[model samples]
Structure formats: structure tokens, C-alpha cells
Target: MLVRTAYRLETGLREAASRVALRIGWTAAVLPYPGYGTQGRARVLGRVLLAPTATDPAARRGVPGWQRLLTLERPGVDVVVELGGSRRTVRSDEGGIVDATLDVRMPEGRATATLTVGERYDTATVHVAPDDARLGVVCDIDDTAWVTNLHDPLRAVWRTLARSSGGRRAVPGMAGLLQALRGRYPDAPVVYLSNGPWNLAGPVARFLEHSGFPAGPLLMTDWGITPRAWFRDGQAHKRSSLERLVEDFPQVSWVLIGDDGEHDPDLYGEFAARHPDRVAAIALRQVVPRPRERAVADDPPPDSDHDGSTAARAPSGTLVVRAPDGTGLLRGLRDALGVEPDRAGDDDVGW
Candidate 1:
């Protein structure tokens, strides 16, 4: 009852704020995120926000992550999405997120969906995987792709809240590694599945592009309160997202990439066990604990013998590799996937 009461209060406050913002001449705008799907269906991802009519162009260049969280959500707004000669109207959720899957026959490769909220318009890119595409890549963002210092809570908060997209550092060689994956499986789709909030979608996309990572859809979750709980379940979100991917692309096998800093190992292990045939391999980035974290660690120290040198097999018979960074993982993946080393040194760049 207390939780329900809190949720109601939060909803009421947001509605009041939305009304005031609209009365003050704030206009509804659509902020689109890249989506992915099969040739028969496409998922459209975006958010509806109420923003000022006149915004400073200069200030928009490198807005800090914190400012993005302060957006006034225009929930339940109608957004018209046009793709593949079909037009459909979808309503935003309570969080102003427009996640609609439309049945439209688009050719394999890149496609665009036009989203219109009121008079404002934006385009979302949707990657349509071919029916024959068997391999896919799923990556975690935080410590796996970039340095978030998740071992230390305070530093992680500082990095997430204070840093701009350009200011945040990318995991060395990760972009080149992803590029190698793309080159090896040209038709395969690489999806970034992160636990980060949807508010940072723009910044995260910018970071991935600027850092030279392969372009793909970002599956992010919302922060704060949900219908049943005060805080969203990050682990549950990852689990459900992975399951949904299996349902959407039943023929595609995935190389799951994440870090051991948190629960990636356990989560990926569970998924691979459930869908053994769907998971091609599991790559875990071994994050060495910080001094403070080590002091309070409950588990024993990792064995030195198994540090990125050996390959293990999960219970599902899927190959598992552990590396400290992307370069090692790329090499391990090459051996596991039976791909020869790149003579052109493409994977050696962006370190």
C-alpha cells in the first residue's frame, strides 16, 4: 500500500509538472534512438520530452549527463512512426518512451523510421538483420565498454553524473574489436545492451560513434520508479532484454560480452544455460577490483593461472573467454571462432 501510494504521488507530480510546462509554452519533441529487428518487423525506439521553444545552439553541443536527466517527460503523447511505406501511431509510456514494434517488410540492412510528435520530427535508424544472419553480438556498456569505476560506488556516480559524452573514456581497443566482429560477420547485427537509463541514450550513442564502435541499436532501461517498485531492477531488465532478443531473432546465435565487475557472469551464464543453442560464446571482461573494493571483498582472490590465458566451457557447452580488455578478448575470440589474425591490423587500432 505504501509503495502504491508513493507511485501515485510521483505520477501526480509529474502530471502537474507536464501541465505547467505546456502552459509555459514548452513544446513536445521526439528524441529517437537506434533500433533493430528482422526484415519482417522493426522496433522503433524514442522518447517524448517537453523542451523550451528556443534553446541555445551552443549549449547543445556537449551537455553533461546530469542535465539530460532533468528533462520534462511528456508521457502518453502520440507519436506517428512511418517506415517501409506503412504509417502507425504509437503512444508513449508513462516515462515518455516510445517503444513500438511494427510489422513492416523492409529489406535487409539499414532502414529509417520517421517519428513525429506534434510538429517536431526525428528519424530513428533501424538495422534489419537478414534471415540468413546467424551471428549477433551483445555488449554491456559500463565497465565492459567504458571505464565507470563500478567497483567504487562514489567514483562511478561521479563519472556517470559529471562527465560529458566526450569526456568519458572508452575501453581501449573495444571499438576496434567490435569493428573486427563486424568485418568477420558482415551481415550480423551488433546490439548494445546496457543497464543505463534511457535519458543518456543520446550521449551513449554519441560516445559509441565518436569512439569508432560499430553502429547498432542501444537497448537501455528507464531509471527511478516503476509501476510496482520505487527503483527499477537493473538485473531483471538485462535478463528480460536478452530473452526478448532470443524471441525476436530466433535463428541468430549471440556472442555475449560483459564484465565481471557486477553480475554479468551470472546473468550471462543463466541465459546461456536456458538457450544453449542461441548463445555462440560468452566473453567476460575481467575487472580487477580496486583497493577499497578488495578490502571489503567477500570472495577469494582470482587464481593467477586462469587470467585470460585459458578457455573454459559453460554448463551449456558454450565457449567462455575471460580477458582484461578488448584486445585479449579479440584474440581469444579469433581462436575460438577459427578466424585468422588480421594482417591489416584493423583490430590493433583505437587502443
Candidate 2:
């Protein structure tokens, strides 16, 4: 069960979100939706839905019905009912709200796709098709994307409080790689899922946009939760957040990128194993990529199959390409995705 705790957003940030909420859906998880990015209205940064775009019929769009946007990260998920079926069906009005389902599948030949939206967990399976396509680029910020010198995370934390965070330099050529991904797949989305908190958005965006990093969707945790709080601490359902992203974008394959310092490799490994095909490639960012960690990403610990991390779905094709600098990870995306394209629709590209 989702225990909604009262999180204390920094007064200043809370005020900003309240003002923006009138224009956008500025809740913590995915905010600024439906307004404000562009003055009176923010660009529809992105919307989460169970169905794919019907405009692209060949693109494997989900049947139009009442489906809410569920998790889109490590265990990518979504739900839809196929009534026409060999299926099941539901009806909705134009603005993306579902009133009710018209009918249930009574015929024996009909197989309704009533994929239920269930409890938020480490891994939840949802409808996914192989032929479908979308943009795919995984991004990371911090010492890798920028020279925040997060080798000492505390210093980075202080820099944010001081609001001098933007003063830090950008990693060499990192922006070029992001630009490259943007240039290559304009329609595909690039997500920055960082350990950074909500307060860093303004400064971080300024630094990234100023230095040339493509400014797109960003995912950050709130600092409001105390570490002792089981879910909120540093371990809030980040994997769940990651799952939400992947599940939301059906076409986009995974181009995982991150540093070795924290659990990026481990997290990405678990994600890759579950949806190997979704993960086109992974570039672990680092100054000197350690051999041991690389080994872990490439070949997770033997007990991974039995471990909670890997217990989600059997691991997938998590190719951990070592990036000398943050730029290297970006460069590797072009290299790996180009040479060996995603399995097209092969969901099971296992270890």
C-alpha cells in the first residue's frame, strides 16, 4: 500500500511548485506536465499512457481505452484492455479520461487483455510488444555529466545550498554526446534519473543548457524524507521510477549511462536483464572505469538470479561500456546502438 506521508518541500521550492501547479501537474514524481515550460503552458514534457500513438499504426500502438500511466523504470510496465478481441475494450473521451468499459469478452474465442494495475513493487509485468519503437537514451548527471566533483557528495550538497552549483564546470564533450543523441533521435526521449534532490533542478538545468546538454525530462528525488523512513530515505522506489520511464515509452530502447560510484551499474544490470532488448546499450561513466564493477555490470554476482535486485525478471543484455569521461558514455551510445540495433521486439535478450 502507498503510505502518503506529508513531505516538507523546502518552503521556497514548495511555493514555486504551488504557483506552477496552476499551470502544470507539479507533483514530485513527474511534474510540470500540461503547463509552464513555455510560459502560459509548458510543453507537454511527456505523458504516460498504456497505449502507443495511434497515428503511427505500424508502430504498434496500444488499443485506445482507459489505461493509466503506471511504472516506467527498471521493471517497465503499463496496462490496457483489448475487447475487440480476440480482445476486450473500454471507452474514453478526447481529453484522456476513461469513463467506463463498454463490454466484457463473453465469446470463447475472445481473450480480453485486462492487465490489472497492481501494487507498486520492485517488478510488475505489463503489456509489451516487440515490433514497437520509441526513442532510447539513458542519462546521468553529477561528476559524470558535470564536474561537480561529487567524489565528495557532501561538497556537491553544499554547492547546491549555496546556489553556486551552476558555477561548476561541465564534463568535456558530455554535452556533445547528449546533443548527438538529441540530433540522432529527436522524437526519442532522454531521461536524467539522478540521486539529486528537487532543489537542484533550476541550477542543474541552467548549467546543462548553458554547457550544451540537451534539456529534457528530469527525474529527481525529494530531500524531504528522512533516511530512517523505510521508503523515502535514499532508497525510495528509484527502481520503480526507472520502471515508469521505460514502460511509458514503448518504442524507445534503453541506452543506459551512469557512473560506478553508486548503484548505477547494479541497478542498470538488473534493469537490462529484465528487458535486454529494451536496453540497446549501457555506458558506465567514470574517470577510470574499475574492472571489478565492469565485471559486475557485464556479469552480475552469481547469486543475482537469487538476489532481490535480479529477482525482478531474469537479467537482460546489459553491455557495460566503460566511459573514460562522461563523454565516453555518450559516445558509446552512438557506437553500440548503431553497430547492433535493439532486438527489434525481442524482449528476452538475456545474460
Candidate 3:
């Protein structure tokens, strides 16, 4: 009883602190824009926002949702971004978020982007990997890579807030398997698409790095109401992300990796159906939400791939592999396309 009361008191204190912080007006920040671009002339995209200081740092630390609510938008602010020694000016929308894509031309290498909102400045760096990276891996982070209990949002929130960096566990051999999926290509990119709020980007990225997963761009969503939706939809965010990726890198063929914990299968399947030629394969991690949900030993449950059929041929010629875990996933990948995933850091990069 005392423990419960203490927790409630702590929560109340945090809420009060957050409210006080929100009332302190807005600060400008340049989000961690995707630092990746192609050779010749490439489009660079990022956002500028006027939000409470609580948003980015708290989100980076994986703080609870209540703290995140302190972030409110300040719109219509003119911002200037410096990219590759050039300056591009853009204005924020009514929601206090600015989406700007500037054209950059340079030889393939790493570049820094700087956003200046009056006197405040924020910077991000991105590498321009070769455009011929045909084999791309797109992954979902929640139950698929990091062990977040998406079955219960409250539990997930608690775990996220309570754990520090390196607290989250990788799903067994999933990290190694993801690295191996890069195949023989020199710069095969692995992009993470999650329904997780943008504030958690730092935590998620830290988790990935600590777990030995390959470095790739993390495409996460902004929490709360945006211009488009009253309550943001994960499905829509993922779909839009996929669309943008394909549109941006039409030359790259993608392999989608996700879990059956939620809508990954349906969304990935829908993507495969729409862009048959672009998707190489779909790998799904079979997860049992609750331990009690597992089948009794006396009567084994149905297999993840429908009665021991591991690979299914999608109408668009994409191979769908459903496996119990990462080991099974590796085996399925080998069977489907003779792919041998490489070790992590073969390219000596954290990005």
C-alpha cells in the first residue's frame, strides 16, 4: 500500500513539473533529420519546430507520455538550414513543424546540416552511401527487434520510462540476423520504421547501437495531434514512410522485417501487394503476447507459417517467411534466396 502511494506521489510530482515547464513558452529545435542522400543532386528532408525543451530530451530518455504532453507547437516561424555549405530558408506550418527538402549536389561522402532559428542552432550529420544499394532492409522495432510489450501500451510506457540505455533486450539473435541480412552489398542500408513517438528516438537509437544492430535511419512518428489526424495512426505513419522511402530510393529493392505482435504482417503484406517488384521478401517474427497464450505441451499450437509451411509466395512474387525467432528467420532467408547475412560493423560505421 505504501509502495503504491509513493509511486502515485512520484507520478503527481512529475505531472506538476511538466505543467510548469510547458507554461514557459517555446524554444526552437532542429530534429535529427535523415542525414542520407544520393550522389549528384539529392533531396534532403528535415523538420524545424517550436516546442518545449521537454520534448526532445525527455523523448530521448524515454520518459513517460505525460511529460511528453508538455510539448506544444509554435507555428509560422521562419527558419534557415545550412546544408553542404548552402543556405535554404523555410517556414513552419500552423502545427509548429516545418518540412523542408532542399536539393544538394556533392560527391558521395558524409555531410553536416545545420538549422538556425534566430540565435539557436542545431546540427545533424549524414553519410551519402552509394545509390546502387539494391538490397535494403526495412525493420519494425517494437516486438520485432527490441522487446517492448506492444500488447499493452501502459506496460510498454512503464518499461520505457523506467529503463535506462542498454536496459532493453534484443530478441535473441535478431541483431546478428539483421546484420547478416545485408548480404554481399557494401552499403546495404537497414532502416527502422516504428510507431514509437519521435521523442523516443534517442532511446531507440541507443538501444539499437547497444544491441549491435546495423546502423540505419530510424523513421519514427510525432506524438499527439498533427495537421492530418485527431489521434495519430501508426499504420498511416508506416505506410507514408514506406511511400517516401520507395519514392526517394527507387533504385533500391527492399526486404521488410516485422513481427506478428500487431499489424506488421498486414501492413507489410499490403506494401508487397502494391509494389510487387520492389519488395524482395517479408520476414515476420512469431510472438506470443502472453506466456499463458502459448499452447500446452500436450497439444502443440499451430505453426506460425500455417502448418509448417515457412515460405509463402505472395502474388507479387515476394517471399513471406514467418519464423519463431531470429534463428528460424535466418534459416528461412537462406532457403528462400541463399542469402548469407554479414557480421555487424563490417563497414566500421555506427550510422
Candidate 4:
């Protein structure tokens, strides 16, 4: 939330909306606080605690309990806030996706509200094209880029807590790597696609901004992805996401970096195969976790680890690549985005 802090220091946190106005559509329940930090950075906070919307007496009295509040995230992000007698779902067996129509006396009176799945960002999602001439770097966050994750789960959890509680922790050599990228393309903004979901938004943002991981448009998933949806999108979604980014801008070349720990290699490989013209290089990070640790922690199984013998076969004629560090690939953001360097270098960019 460096951005928010800087802004408050300049213009101060807006007190006018202290009571918490606005209803987040059940699909996206996020309160947008412009500049929660200082200067032009975002300082997100858990201040906007949310609950089921209050209603008139007649509306409140007439409610159904069977209308399951299908929980999307299987692990349950933290705690579920009761709907105050509102219809609730029994189970949302999906990864974090469930569909349940609300039952209300005045059915039309039912409105959607977004619960805090727990994440925040400073950059607006950027649209990119795979074949742009400008440099486009896709960096992984775990050990390859730094060393925040890929360690003892208990210690990692504690580090996460410390960030929320105002503790500062940094991954060695991460900021320098980011600065290195910045030096390469001072104008082209970077995007981070992490396996972490919206649940870690607040804490993750706190860690990255302080540590330096190109705090720009970060593409993260909501923990609420349905099991079926997760299965369906596993490799396809990530590949499509990167491709869509390439298509949206159409003026950059992609430098894909990720660790062999997850599906980064697979996704990057698929993108490279289908749009071979756009992808320049692929880098995989080498993790040092013990095999016992790997077996215990690799929940849901990382796709890359399994692809050692078998490869994902996509219709686009794309094949996945396994890597140890993302830096091995660098066609440049200009080539990845398909944008003119001189032109991209002059645009106003904070996202």
C-alpha cells in the first residue's frame, strides 16, 4: 500500500466514505480506495470490513436458510460472515466457485454483494499482444525471482502474518532483478502472474511493494474458483491469459520466467508454441526444497513436475517447457507487446 501511504501524506485518506458505502456485486466485492498509500502507489488495508447488506424489517424477516451460500474456496479463506438469516448454501464443492440462486419473498429485492476474498492491487489489468516488438517479461514470484515461498510452510505462514502486522521481509536479490528489468525497459510496465489467489492480496501486496517485484499489473485468481473450473482452466486458462495479453496489445515480445515448481513452464511453453513468433525465451527457477517437503507441500500437484514424462497436448499445436529460472528468456517487452518502442516509452504508465 505504498501508493496509499504516499497519497494520504499528500491529500489524506478520504474520510467522507468512512461508513463504507457501495455494494460489491457478488461476483466482485472490493471497495476501491484510490491511493491508500503515499504518492502514486496503492496502500490497501483491511479497514473496509464487510458484512451482509442490512435490509428493511419486512425484507429482513423474510429469508430462507436453505439457499446455500456456496463457499467458493475449499479451504475457506478465513471465516465466513453469516448472512444474518439470509439463504445460505450447504456446500460449494468447487475450487472456489459455486452457483446458488437466492430465495427471497420479494425475489426482485435480492441484490448481489461481493465478499472480501482478500486481495488488492495498484495497477489496472493491462491488455497485451504476444507479438509486439517491445519487451514483455513474465516473472514468477517464488524462489526463481526471490525466496519468499518454496520454504517451510510454517515459516512462510508466519512471514505472511508479519506483513499484515507491519513486519518487513525481503527476498534476497529480488529487488535487484526487478530493477534490472526496469533498467532494460524503463517505460514498459511489467505484469506478474502468480499462483497465489486474491486471498493473499493485502499481505502479498505489502510484501512485493517493499521488496520490489515490479509492483504493476498483477494477475491473480480468486480463491473461489470452482473445482471443475480450476480443472478446466489449469493449463488452458494461464496460456489463454498470456495469449490474450499478447493479443490485446499486439506489439511486444514475451520473456517468460517461472520455476519448475508449478505450471509456469507448461503455460509458457503452450504460449510459445501457439504464438512462436511472439515468445522469445523461457526461464525456469531451480527450487531446493527436500523431496519429503515437496511431497507434503505439493498439494493439487504442480503441473510442471508431472509433465516430466507426459506433455499437455493443446489444439493450438503448443507444447509446454519446464524451467528453473524465468530470466533465461528475454525477447524484450517491446517484442512481446508488439508495440513501437519509442511510442510505448512515452505513454503514462502506473499500472
Candidate 5:
């Protein structure tokens, strides 16, 4: 009863604020996110927000990450999405997120979709993976791809607030590792699945591109109060996103990459156990010493058998590799995938 009351109060406050913003001449704008799709269907992802009039220069310069979090959302707004020669009107959710799956056919490779809200418009890049593609990649963002220091909450918050996306450092060798995977499987799609809020999508996407990581789509969750809960469940978000990927791309076997600072090992283990055939391999970057507290039964203990140089098959028959950085994981991944090292360019490859 208390939860329901709090949700109602929150909804009421948001509605009141929306009305005031509209009365003061705030206009609706569209923020598009890169989405992934198969050959036959495409998922359009975006957000609708209430922003200052067209005269504001910040609209053109792009808002910073912290400012983005403070912006007002215009929920239930109508956004027209045009892709593959088809036009559809989709409604944003209560959180102003437009997540619509349309049955539009497009050839394999990168495609563009236009999203329009009133006079404001943005193009969302959609990656269409070939149906015959055998391999796909799902990577975590926080510690696996970039150095966010998630284990240290205070430092993580400070860095996120102080640093621009370009200023943030990418995990050494990770970009090269992802690029190598792309080189091997040219048609494979790379999906970044993170527990971070959607407000940081722009920054995260920028970081990935500027750091030379192969781009695909970002699947991030919304933060703050929900109708049913007060705070978002990060672990549940990751788990559900993983399951949805299995449903979205049934034929593609995924190479899951994440760090062991949190619940990644346990979560990936459970996923591999449930869908053994869907997973090709699991690569875990040892961001920090394995936590002393065992949060779950499936969490793998500290690596004592090898010095982050070998790939071992897990109990579920999936190959698992652990490394401190991408270079070590690259070696283990090559071994697991049975690919020869590109010795000619190995020395120059910096992630």
C-alpha cells in the first residue's frame, strides 16, 4: 500500500511538472539510440524529452551526462520512425523511452532510421545482422570495456561526474580484442548490454566509438522509481537483457564478455547453464580481486589454476577465460576459437 501511494505521488508530481514546462513554452525533442535488428525485423530505440526552445545552443552542442540526468522527460509522446521505407508511429513509455519492434526488411549491414518529434529530428543507426551469421558479441561496459572503478562507489561517482566521455580511459587491449573478433566474424553484431541508466547512453556510445570498439547497439535500463519498485535491479536488468538477446537472435551463438568485479561470473554462468548451445565462449576480465563474500553459488572462485593465460571449459561445457586486460584475453580467446595469431600486426595492436 505504501509503495502504491508513493508511486501515485511520484506520478502526480511528474505530471504537474510536465504541465508547467509545457505552459512555459518548453518543446519536445527526440534523443535517438542505436538499435540492432535481424534481417526481417528492426527494433527502434529512442527517448522523448521536454527541452528548451530551438534558440538554446546547448541543444545543438549536446548536453553533458549530468545535465542529461536532470532533464525533463515527456512521457507518452508520439514519435514517427522511418526505416526501410516503412513509416510507423510509436508511443514513448512512462519513462519517455521509445522501444518499438517493427517488421521491416532491410539488408545486412548498417542502416539508418529517422525519428521525428514535432520539428525536432534525429537519426538512429540500426545494425542489421545477417541471418546466417554464426557469432555475436555481448559486452559489459563498466569495468570490462572502460575503467569506471565500479568496485569503489565513491571513485566511480567522482569519475562519472568529473570526466567527459572522451576523457574516460578505455580498458587497454579491449578495443583490439573486439576488433579482432569483428575481423574474424565480419558479419557478427556486437551488442553492449549494461546496467547503467539510459541517460548515459550517448556518453557510452561516444566512448565506444572514440576508443575504437566495434559499434552495434546499446541496451541500457532506466533508473529511479518504477510503478512496482523504488529502485531498479541492475542484476535483473542484465539477466533479462541476456534472455531477450537469445530470443531476438536465435541462431547466433554469443561470446559474452564482462568483468568479475560484480555478479557477472554468476550471471553468465547461469545463462550458460540455461542456454549452453547459445553461448560460444565467456571471457571475464579480472577487474579487482575476486570478492571475499560469496553472493551466489554459481560465482566462480579466484583463479588459482592458471595465471590468466589459459582457457578452460566450465562445468556447463562452455569455454571460459580470465585475464587482467584485453591482451591476455585475446590470447585465450584465440586459443579457444582455434585462431592463429596475426604475428605481423600483433606488436602494433594497442587496445
Candidate 6:
């Protein structure tokens, strides 16, 4: 009885200290969405945080450091964002997110937006796929880009918390495939959509850069409970993002890429079905399900059984790739977009 009482006291003290630390460490943070639109009226989206210091030890390993058990939304804070010569001010929502539009005259190329909250400033870039560009690529991060064992939640979290960009391993040849896609369509845009928590954005961005992948905008999400749901739906996040992208760029045809480990197949399939004309191709990575996956699963048969035969039903041009280290994706894209040899002499290589 005495030991139990002591443990309770210790736990209470730790909670109290954590609360105090959060209160003291709160600061302004801006999470900017990669804004894309036409020159006349481009839209900008971002979140403003009276952000508390992230205390999770996993942060050092590569998970988002700005995320915490408690979210302190600073509603009504005024934010200023600038692009080229145009500047605009908007207030954060009750959730501390800012979704605003700005008028700017940007010449063809990647454009940068500078967001400022008092002296704290951060920059985010947006891609403007050329008017005549034929294809766009929407990519998934987990099993599609690299292997993070989503089937085993604990193992996934440990890998994220223990690895740095250099320490982390990207799927071999994945970068080459993306780079080659850019080579095929010089002006095409590649957007990364991940259900991974936004706190790990820094590491993910670094990993992409180090791997020589083409540059584009990242759309990530927060990983805590919200008012309507007990837990966040990652599929829901990807769904909305895809909807927004399709709506925003009506003229651009998209090639979807993801792994079979999660809901990418279903989500991409559904998305392609709805917007058949806009979707050019859908590529899914074939992942071997682990023992834990079998023990905990009911629906969605394992990869070997599913075999992506069902994906063909999702869209007219859908196919599953083995993701044989990246060759599978390369082959899929080759069939979909007509893979071309990358020329180092040409300027198409870099962002």
C-alpha cells in the first residue's frame, strides 16, 4: 500500500512538471501548406501554433518534435505571408490554422512564400506545374517511399524515433524513378501526401532532399484526437488532400503511387473511379504482411492473396507493382507515362 501511494505521487508530480514546462515553453509555430494556383489569385494554407515544446524523446530520432498530447490552439492571431511583391494578412481559426489567398504575379518556376508571425519566420515552396504539362505524381511516404513497419505500430514508432535522415534508408531506386518521371515531363509537379504526423516533417523533407528526389510540397497531418472523432483517420486526411488537389488543378492529369500495406489501394482506387478522366494511372507497392498483420487483421487480404488484381477494377489503367526495391514502380510509371532515360546534361534533373 505504501509503495502504491509513492508511485502515484511520483506520477502526479511528473504530470504537474510537464504541464508547467508546456506553459513556459509555448511559442509561435507556422506550418505552411505548399500553395499553388494561377498568377491572378493563388491560395495559401498553413497552421499557426502557440506551439508548446514537444517533449517526446522520439523527436530526436525523427518524429515531429512540435507534437504533444495537448494542443494549444491560439485562435485569432494575425499572420502575414509574402510571395513575390504581394503580401497578405489573415487570422488563425479556432484550430490555429490559416487558409488564405494572396494575389501575386509570379513568373514561371517554383515560388517561395515567406510567412511571418512577429519575428518568427518560416518559408514554404509551391509548385506550378506548367500549363502544358501532361502528368502529375502524387506519392505516399510509408511503404511506398520507404519502409516504416505500419503493420506493427510499436516498431514503426521506434524506427521513426530512432533514425535520422542519413540513418534512415529509402527504397532503392525510388528517387531515381521520381527523378526520371520529372525527366519525362519536365514541367510536371510531384506532390507528397502522407498520413504521418506533421511533427516529423523536418526529417521527411530532409530524407527526400538527401535521396535526390524532385522537390515539391508536403501535406502532413496532426496525430491527436479531435472534437468529432476519438482517433484521427489517416485515410480521411489523404482523401481530402486528393480532393483538394483534383479540384485545384483540373487541367493536370495525375499518376497515383502508394503501397498496399495500408488504405492507399482502396483510397487511390476510389479516387480514380470518381475522377476517371483526371487520373492517368495508379501504382501500388506490393508489401508482405507480417505475422502481427495477420493476427490483428480481418478485412483486406494479405498482399500475396490480393495481388492487385482487384486494383484494375478501381480504374481503367490501374496496376499493382512489386516495388522490387523501386523497379516495380519504375515499370509501372514506364507503362503509364512512357519512361524516358534521364540526361544529366539537361537542366531537368534538379528542382
The C-alpha stretches of model 5 lying farther than 4 A from their native spots are: 1-6, 55-64, 291-307, 343-351
* Candidate 6 structure quality by residue, lDDT tens digits, 1-351: 555565556446545654665579766667666666543556676776554544322234433333332344455778898887889998987556677777665665678887877656667675656656667889899867777867778877866666655666787667877887787787777889999766566678778888887887787776654455545789999999999888666777887877767788678777876787888777666665431221112234424322122223232444434444455456444544554534354323322
Between 1 and 2, whose TM-score is larger? 1
lDDT of 4: 0.40
Q: List per-prediction Cα lDDT, in the order shown.
A: 0.82, 0.45, 0.66, 0.40, 0.82, 0.65
Say which prediction, candidate 1 or candidate 6, comes out ahead on TM-score: 1
Rate residue 31 of model 5 by lDDT.
85
> TM-score of predicted model 2?
0.54
Candidate 1, residues 1-351, lDDT tens digits: the string is: 777888888889888988898899988888888998794888989988888777521136577778878877888899999999888999998888999899988898889999998877888899999978999999999998889979889999998889888899998767777888888899889999999999888788888999988889999998887668888999999999999999889899999998879888888988988998998888777776431221111134432323253356776777777677887778767766767766576446322
lDDT of 2 by residue, 1-351 (tens): 123333233334444544555254322121111110110111122121222212211122221111111211111223233333323222322212221222322322112232222221111112121223355666777666776555567766554454443456777666776676666665445666677754354456556667877655566664443323424544344587668666555556777667666667677777776777687766665643343444344344422211111211224545556655544444344445563423344221211
lDDT of 5 by residue, 1-351 (tens): 777788899879878988898899988888889998895889989998887776431233344456657767788889999998988999998888998788888999889999898988888999999988889999999998999899999888876766668678999889988998998889989999998888888888888998999999999998877667888889999999999989889899999998889888889878988998998899888888653232222335434334454456666888877778888788777756768756566444422
Clashing pairs in 6: 64-199, 64-200
In model 2, the runs with Cα more than 4 Å from the true position are 1-133, 226-231, 235-237, 287-315, 339-351
The TM-score between candidate 3 and the true structure equals 0.76
Q: What is the TM-score of each candidate against the true structure?
A: 0.90, 0.54, 0.76, 0.46, 0.90, 0.75
- For candidate 1, give the lDDT of residue 229: 88
Better of 1 and 4 by TM-score: 1
- By lDDT rank, best first, the candidates go 5, 1, 3, 6, 2, 4
TM-score pick, better of 2 and 4: 2
Per-residue lDDT of model 4, residues 201-289, tens digit only: 44445456667666554555443223233223545556665875575436666666666555665566666656876665554554544
Candidate 2 vs 6: which has more lDDT: 6
Q: Which lDDT value does model 1 have at 62?
A: 77
